[model samples]
Target chain A: MLPVRAGIGLRHPHHREFLERQPPIGFVEVHSENFFGDGGRDLDVLGRVRADHAVSLHGVGLSLGRADGVDPAHLQRLARLVARIEPAVVSDHLCWGAIGDAHWNDLLPLPMTPAALDVVATAVSRVQDTLRRPILVENVSAYVQPDLADAMPEAEFVAQLVARTGCGLLLDLNNVYVNALNHGFDAQTAIDAMPAVAVRELHLAGHFVGPDCVIDHHGDRVCDAVWALHARFVAQHGARPTLIEWDTDLPTLDVLLEEAAHAQRILDRTRESVDA
Target chain B: MRDALAHWQRAFGAAIDGAATLPALRGDAATVARRFGVYRNNVRLARMAALRNAYPVIAALVGDAFFDGLARRFASTYASTAGDLNAYGAAFDAFLAAFEPAQALPYLPDVARLERAVHVAWSAADSAPFDVARLASLDAAAQAALRFTVRPGAHALVSRWPIAAIWNAHQPDAPHGFDFDAASPPYFALVRRDATRVRVDTLDAAAHALFVASAGGAPLADALDAVVAAAPHADAGVVLGTALRDGWFDDAPAG
Candidate 1:
């Protein structure tokens, strides 16, 4: 299991340095789809890195909220990978990306209606059953808000998913912050709605404020507001396995390490408070 | 997949694909379109990036603008069947073959094929070296009828254009004025991952035929016949020896 400390998302650029240095972090998270290949350099790197450090298989595919259902082929590949790696944690976004024949390969937002809730819960339960372990479902950053008239609040949708499926929540504070600004909701209240103990992991990433909406690009440093939100969450719910996720315009390993160190410091402070 | 939620997902997918105008999702039409554009942009950019990653040589040959346009067309023409983005552009070479604008560069399709092969080899499965000892232990008759399994990441590509030379020309350390004759002999390339890197080794027709036969599950004797048929004057024994030395076949028990 992942330690309740901080880790960095391991991207391609840092594979060599990450393996060589074996940085003193809690664990390293990788996109599960990236290593789904039968074999190759990425799998080799993952195997080597996993030998020493804890690993988290954060997936972008699986389309866990697909109305039709989760793709059995995709689920099988994920199961094969999970069996091989036995990662500290496995998670995918609570968004749909495919319908019928096509997969958009992006975390498209799902409506928060009861039917959509049933779709997500069924899919999540199927995935957990296949993997023989519960998986965490993360709240995706949304650009287009669903029809609020027919939909429940995003927090309630997520809470019901957890209560129904017995899965964990990967509380992405960055997504929470972005969605709050875009949809005109209070981020703190959204956090408050979650079952606190069900938050198995926390995600901290940077987003771009687009002209129309706040985009979850994950291309910059964690913003001050999100950091404050994270601190508040930790102060209230105690520490979780937090990750520093940077996907585009990736900086050197040092930048990610520094960010991870910052997160570790927050986690450490929470421990100190608990001790006192 | 026609439940109410599925209907909504399909409509949302259509809007993202530019198939249908902004569905009356939530909010006013203008406001909805503006917000929905974000998903469209993200999908296009992410899929385009996958194609760019798979076919860097093609991107370099065609400038970024042209390549981006081609990628957009290809993304629309072919549905992405795989959840993994890396597997998105397998049909790009086929698409480029009939692409109107790219027809000017007749060799572009072949180059795309070479790039796809390289991209695949970069992460293809690793296998143990061919077991020479096991092969030797077989009696003469058994050895003659042995059918070998091709190793993962080992592919033999024969193109009329000098695809290997074209790909090498675009490499980071390639010569400044590298050129190749379009009329040159067909290029037979063996693309394989050797522990550290995927290398493109140029081969004679006889050797190429041998590799192709092995990939097709032809017995050793029939593969040797294929080698002789491809190049009447070439030595089949020498070609087979080269294939063995290169570890083209997997060490798994032969069929």
Candidate 2:
């Protein structure tokens, strides 16, 4: 199990520093697809780092919400990696990325309807069975809101998925914040509807605010609102394994460690209050 | 509604592919188009980034605006068939070959091929190194019949253009005053992975033939004969010795 502390997403630029310094961060998360090669420097480096730190295999290519079903070849590669790494936690986003044989290579939002819910639940179950362990499903930031008249709330869809598949929740707070802002909803309400027991992890990342919408680019520092939301969730739901993700225009190791240090402070505060 | 979900995804995909302007999404038409534009842009940008990562030299050869347009056209024409982005750009080299705007720069296609080879060599599966002592242990006749295997992703490409020099010139910290003359002699590149880095070495005509023959599973004696035939004055011993020292060949496939 991952500790109730903070971690950082491992990017390519900081691999050497991570190997050499062996920072005191609680764990490190990596994009599962980046190391999916049969063998290479990325995989070799991941093996070396795994010996010292707790690692999380966070995936983006699973396409867990696709209507056509998950890709078997992708699942096979993921299974191979999991068998080798024995990661502390495995997780992927709740988004569809492909239709038929064409892959968009971007996380596309799914319509939050009953039919869509069934598709996602089945896919999640299949992935859990294949991995032989429960995996966490992260809520993605949606720019295109599903306009279906009978569309259920995003929280309801996720809650039902957890109940049906016995899967855990990787509650990405920044996604919640971004979606709330883009779609005009209450962030706290979204957080309140989450199945508390199923939440095994939390994600904090920065976003780019565009003309029509806010983009979850994972490129900047976490905003003040997201930080407050994270504190509230930790205080209410207690602490989970939280991660700071920065993907584009990556900064140095010191910056990521500093952000993680801030998260650790929030977790520590919440832990003390709960203990008292 | 099961059909509707799939239908919606299809329409949405069409919009992303630039086959249609916008899907029948909810909201005002202008607002919906504006929002949908974000997804369309994301799809194109992500695929373009993958191509850029694989062929940095190609991008460097053509400026950003031109490369962006070329990548956009290629992406729309060839849909990525795999979830792994690494597997997405294999056809870009071919796409560049038939591109009309890029005809003046004929070497671009070959350079793209070399870049793809470098990427494949970098990520291909690991293999055991060649066993020198075991070869000595074999009887002379047994050794002559032995067929060698190069490490996974190792490749030999002979091009009329100076593709290897162009690729090397674009690398960071590459020496200045590189002669970009298309009139220079053609180059043969032998791509191999050393430790973690992919090395692209220029080879002579005879050496290239030997590598191709050996990599094609030719018997040791037959491969050497081909090398000797290519250049009568070339010393077969020295050529094979250089290949061995460079960690080119993996252990011969089991019996």
Candidate 3:
């Protein structure tokens, strides 16, 4: 089982640190595509890191929310990696990234319509079948929720997905905060709509405050508002295995650990209250 | 894919691919339309970043602005079918070969091809070394008929320009006293990835002929004959010794 504590996303910069000295964190999550090579230097690096700590395979390329079927080859590759690594957690975002055969190679938004939900649910079910294990699907930050036909808000769509597909939710708090800010919705309300039991993990990442929208760049330090939201989130939803995701312009490993330490404080506080 | 999603993707793709207007989204039309630029810029940049990471030497050869422009153009022209972005730019060498903008740098395409091979070799499948003892135990006549397989991470490349020198010159620890512009004989590149580091060696004509032939599953005697025929003055012993050190041969076929 994944520990109910905080960990940082593993990037190339801190690989030496992890290999030489294991960090005091629960587990390290990696973008699965980076080590997707059949057998190579990158996989070797992953192997070394996996030995010292628990590893989570977080996928960015699966396009689980696409309307079309999941690519069998992609599934095959992912299955091979999963079989080899045996990660504590396996996940992809709750977003569509492909249209026809062309993959934008980015986490893209799906309309909150019934049709979109059907497409996403079907895709998730297919992936679950392929892996023969339940996978966590995270919410994505969208600049523009496309104009489309009937349905509910994004939260409702995701909540229904957990029920329909039996996949756990990787509730990305930053995405919720960014989406609420971009589309003028209450972030707490969105979180409230989610089924708490289904939320097995939480992602806390920094965003770039762009001119028009807050871009989920995963660069820099997490903002105060998001941290506050996380504190509130843990108090209400109860703590899960939260991850501090810092991608671009990565700081020193110590800096990442400090961020992880911050989340750990929140987790401990939440756990203490439950015990009390 | 449904009709609505497909239609949105068409407009969204066009908008990101070009200066086309953003597709109408569910929210405030004007605000959301303006905000869509983030995704547009991101998709374009993300694709460019993947290519840049794969072809760093090419990017270094061309300045940042030049590389960025080239990458963007490549991203716009080619639709990435693979879910993995790392596999998206496989056709970049071919694309660069025909690219009119880079016509001035004729050697650039070949360099790109060499770089792509290096990138691929880094992740190629693992292969055990050839059992030299088994080969030595065999009769000379038996050895003559034995076919050899190249290591999975090995790729052979031939280019007119000193591609190896150029690639090495750009390395952080480029050796002292090596000249990139000096005229030299054509070189055959033996690119191989052994565990951590990937090396690209410029092989002599004889070694190239012998190894290339051997890598393609040529029998021992025939391969040596090809090397002697290609360059009669070539040292046969040196060629064989180099091949052994380079982990070139998987002599024993899989049982």
Candidate 4:
């Protein structure tokens, strides 16, 4: 089981830092495809980190909502990695990134309709079958929300996904907040309708604040509003394995650890309430 | 419905692939265009950063602004078929080789190719080190017939320019040691993974010839013969000793 505590996203810049010091944190999460190569320094670094920390493999390029089935080669590479690491939690976005052979290399959101839901559910089942274990699918921050003719709400679509595939939800609260601002949805209400028990992990990340749009850039400190949303979700659904994700324009290791510590405090408070 | 999805996918691809025009999304065109611009920028910026990461020396050589422009152009022209961003720009070297604006810097393509090799060497599959003791045990005849397998992703690329010298000069951490030979000698870059880091070193002519031949699956005698054919002054024993000491080849049965 994934630990009900705080963790930080392990990125390339901090690999050397992690090698030199074991900071106070519950676990470390890494982008799964970074280690897709046969065997090399990144894999070696991951193995070393695994020895000391419970690792979560967060993937970005799975493209689970594609009309076609998931790519067999990408699935095989992911399976090999899961076998090698036996990570505490494995997760990918609930977004379609590629269309056939062209991979955008960015998580593109799915339409909140039955068709997209079926596509994602089928792909999630395929992934679970391949790994012989359930995986968490994260909600993505999207600029354009598809106004499909027969659209279900995002929460209902995700809940249906969980019900059909037996996979858990990686409720990215930051995405919820981002979407709320972008699409004029109530963030709390959307999250409140999710299958709470099926949420296996939570993601906290910083977003870029633009005048016209809020971008999920993961480059800055987590804003207060995202934290507030995360707090409400923890209060309602209980604590899961929460992660602090920082991608580009990375600060020093100490700054990342500082964010992780803030998350740790939240987890502790949430756990106390659950126990009480 | 599947075709509809594919159509939308293609439109989405067009929207993000450096096109200013909006695809026919299901929302208000004006609103959708403003919002969708975010995704377009995301795709362009993310892929640009990936290329920038993979080819830091090239980016440094061309300056940041020119590199960004080059990246945007590459992103527009090529579709990254692979899911991994690291694997996205396999065509970049070839793209640079024929790119019009970059024609001013003729050697940039080889430099791009070298950086890609170094990037590949960094994450290449690990192979067992060459066991030199096995070479001592073999009979002279069998030794000559012995084909060697080098560490994975280990090979030399022969270039018409002083590519190694140029690459070294561009590297932020590389020492200012290698002389930019005025003769503009063709360079052979030996790419190999040592411990946790990938090292791209300039090999002498004899060593380069041997690596080029052996990396292509030539036997020891054949590799030496190629070296002799290429340069009669090449010292076969010294180069062999150098390769062995560098853990270039794993002593395994030729399959």
| Stretches > 4 Å off in candidate 1 | B173-182
Give the higher-TM-score candidate: 2 or 4. 4
Provide the lDDT at B26 for model 4: 58
- Residue A91's lDDT within candidate 3 is 96
**A1-276: candidate 3 lDDT, tens digit per residue:** 478999999998788777787877988899998887868777888888887778889999888767665788888899999998888989998777786677788888877778778878888898889889999999899988787767587778888888899999898999999989988898888888888788888899999888888889999888888899889989987888989999888999888999999999999999999999
Tell me, per candidate, how large a share of the native contacts it keeps. Answer: 0.68, 0.63, 0.71, 0.64
Whole-model lDDT for model 1 versus the true structure?
Answer: 0.88
* Candidate 4 collision pairs: none
* Residue ranges of candidate 3 with Cα displaced over 4 Å: B19-24, B99-104, B180-182, B251-255
**What is model 2's DockQ versus the real complex?**
0.67
True contacts kept of 4: 0.64
Q: How big is the positional error of residue A116 in model 2, measured in Å on the Cα after superposition?
A: 2.0
**Residue B249 error, candidate 1, Å:** 1.0
lDDT tens readout by residue for model 1, B1-255: 227778778878888888756544666677677888888888888888899988888999999999999998987777788778989988898899999999999888888888888988887878877878888899989988999988888887888887877788788888875566657678888888877577787788999999999899999999999999999999998888888888888988778
Error of 2 at A25 (Å): 0.7
Each prediction's Cα lDDT score? 0.88, 0.87, 0.83, 0.84
* TM-score of predicted chain B versus true chain B for each candidate: 0.90, 0.91, 0.88, 0.91
Clashing pairs in 3: A147-B26
Candidate 2 lDDT, tens digit per residue, B33-107? 788888888888788888988989999999998999999898778888889898888988789989999998988
- Model 4 regions more than 4 Å off: B18-27
